[model samples]
Target: MTTNSIALFFMTDFSIPKPNHNKALKTLAPPSLAGKGAGGLGFSPLIALAAILLNLAPTPAIATTVKIDRWSTTSDRVTLKVKVLNNNRIPILGLEEQAFRVKTKDKFGNPHTLQSPEIRVLSPEESHPQQTYVAILLDMSGSMKQKDTARVKKLDGAVNAIRGFINLVKAENLPVDISIIPFGEGCNHSYQVTTKTIEDNFKSASNSELEKQLDELAKVPVCAATNIYQPLTETVKYLRNRFPPSPSEIDAQDKPLPKLSVILLSDGFHVYRNNEPQQFENVINLLKQNSQITVHTLGYGESLAHLRNRAICFKYIPDDRLTVDDVANGCRLPGSDIQEFIVDEDRLKKIAQTTGGIHEFPEDAEAVAKSLKTFFTTLREYEIIYQQPGSDRATIHPTKIEINSPDRGINTLQSETENIRMSNFIYRALTFTQRLPLLILTVFIGLVGVLPFIQWSKKLKQQSDL
Candidate 1:
């Protein structure tokens, strides 16, 4: 409309109201906030509305209050335990998938975004205070009879340190299932996981059968030398059977099974059994198969570099000889085949790394106990189950899982998980077809070698008949 038409329209439609009681009340109202801009009573109506809108606007940021506890991945799913708190440092629960945005980064430092990922929030009772199972494999081999430079007997140190740890577990009142097996007492299948100290709760941990076994182990040293293979493999098998990945109880399906931590402590190298090295490898594989299991190894009393010259297997350890296979399988380090004692700190470091656990070399028995306490506290309480939509294209082992609140009211969270196995049928088939030529060539070579031998045998038989 033209300015003249606009003035005529407003004059006709919104003509000035006649003086009345309502206008008198408006005249007497507080002048500071009353609308007054277009004319004497004209309004800047947007000022209060603008303030209200700003107050209701979404907050853009908050201090980081998220910490990851522990995380693991299935072939297809990534599970994580984390602590998420609001600005008030209060745990924020009962949130839906829309409340979080998820993404992942592979071990190679490449990024992948996930879309509409499903999130399952477990109940606090089901996860946050879940029970934890720990196995303390104390070496009671003959070498325990030796003492450290501090005059602390290896056996006494192990037993006493264990005694202290058990006390700490009780003091903390942590819900745990523990096993204290003293192996290396006998050779072959003679030694076993005979001492099991388990409790549903922490109150009964003290003076349990585990303590009784500890008391007995402190006084005596085993007749045989160190045999890490038998004890470690047996422990893993026991844990796997006891706390299976798939639970049978109906209530357990909603949550995950408790994690198992195997603490393998030894002062000397592996010996006694000739196949200890191979058996140790099998133990590592077993732990790897179950992502929930972590093996924390402590090389007590000595460092890995120092143990080379003092080959415990060759010198003080009994039977003191390697089998033909043991000699062939070779030593732990780059040295004479006879120089190793099977399980050294060098090998122990690798086991911890492969299982996603930490390896610590403690100088004495006190340090050993100190390390044990540290591992127990790191157990996970809550788990987040989500499928990474980009897992199909993921090439790395342990992709990083990153979590953020859409409103930025929580800190960014990160956890790592391995990619789902290569499940594409075409990929598996292609890999097989890729190796087919080599397999066929080997078979052809074998046939060529067998035919000449068969011909020679037939000719000899014919000559004898003549």
Candidate 2:
């Protein structure tokens, strides 16, 4: 994705809503002057100050929305779209120059600033464009058995879903680097398949090869233990290594990394031996920590409810669970009743809510295909970027974003987008080393100056009274 393909536009009304006025002022204020008193100062001075501060404050920066017209044979690039908004419901705009300062560092430790001309002002109806790598993590454990007689196996459903997802991405002609990690006892070596090979392979995958790889999974006996933690850790390690060291280190060796999309399928409860909640928690923590990876978990069989509940309660679980039989029946019979069960509908809903992915129960192969299609459609429409306010590196920071589109009846943001929607406005202070010195200096300054000012003010007031 080249800079020209991405466009960013801003909408500025300068009209501050009542509750937002304080926040607007706070954000607009210089870091040094953030805590100054408002007093009884009237509206005019406040407005003047606000305008000056807006002009002097850092202009709102936005990630460029690049369009991937076609995959480059020489380099891989992913396109994504990012939208900017303020505390008010207004979409932020009018500061194109300021948006250019937004920088993304590649894996190689070099920073690249977003190009200004590439950002086009988006109208309310418009969407910003962007892209990234798509990392697929598949679960090939033995527990992916089918409950129904007519339905295909759970592993088959997963593989079919993956194939469809890959095809859709390729059809877009986007430069996507496809990596397949099949995890059973452990993760398989990543198949860094190129767009051409992926397309050709899908096309020429003989019915036998397709059936063997896409629909038939190695049915290890139920006794085989599922080691989900290993794969999760391995995948993350692979991604951290795969991403360019930094954004500016673009060389032949530095082909752009695809935004990561992880699809994890399993059926049994997470392996717990000894006081291993810590192990499970660690896996969850790793998933939560990576902002770049979107994890979708598909839980088949009786344990679907448990897996769905866990994934839904945590942001690390991106997609909802779909029973293997339901998906297979959906594929085989379209809208027919496949007698598939939803163990915990509310919990599954919550999982879908917490993770940015959807909860779908496919009744047949076509329905499975449809679910995959829907997921890919949402993926295409997503506004992906790697920008966290007040930080330069891609470290994990909790965020909440709410979208109130009354006209479209879109009142909520879900999945990865929902992370930007919390009400608590606390920012986790940087690590101790990064904050201690500044904290000490602040205390010293307040003691030396603010104490003296307070004393002097008190003395002056006493004299005036006398």
Candidate 1: which pairs clash?
A: 398-417, 398-418
- Encode model 1's per-residue lDDT on 1-466: one tens digit a residue: 2111101111122367444322321325586746767445445446545555666664433434454445545444666566554333323443345444445654455666653446665533245555677787777666566666567877787788778877876776667666776666554423455324222212235548668767877766455556676677777777777767652111244444675778888776666445666776777787788766778787776643234334322222113442323332432333533322223666677777766566777767777776765454444334567764444533333344455555444345654443333222212223677789989999999999999999999999999999
Please give the distance, in angstroms, between residue 364's alpha carbon in candidate 1 and its true position after superposition: 1.2
Superposed Cα deviation of residue 229, candidate 1 (Å):
0.9
Question: Tens-digit lDDT track for model 2 on 1-466?
Answer: 2211222233345675434212321224455555555553333567766776666653432322222211111111222344332321122333232232233433443544444343222331233323444445454444454532237666566667778776766666554555555555433422332333333333221234543555434433322345555665666656655553333223255343445555554444334345555775676666566545655554444434333332222122223535433332332222432223333333333333343445554444445555565455444332333333333223322332233333322343321311121112334447899889999999999899989899999999999999
lDDT of each: 0.57, 0.43
Ten contiguous residues minimizing lDDT sum, candidate 2: 68-77
Q: Cα miss at 434, model 2 (Å)?
A: 48
Runs in model 1 lying further than 4 Å from the true structure? 1-80, 83-127, 187-190, 194-207, 247-255, 272-277, 307-343, 380-413, 417-466
Candidate 1 TM-score versus the reference:
0.50
- Number of the predicted model whose TM-score against the real structure is largest: 1
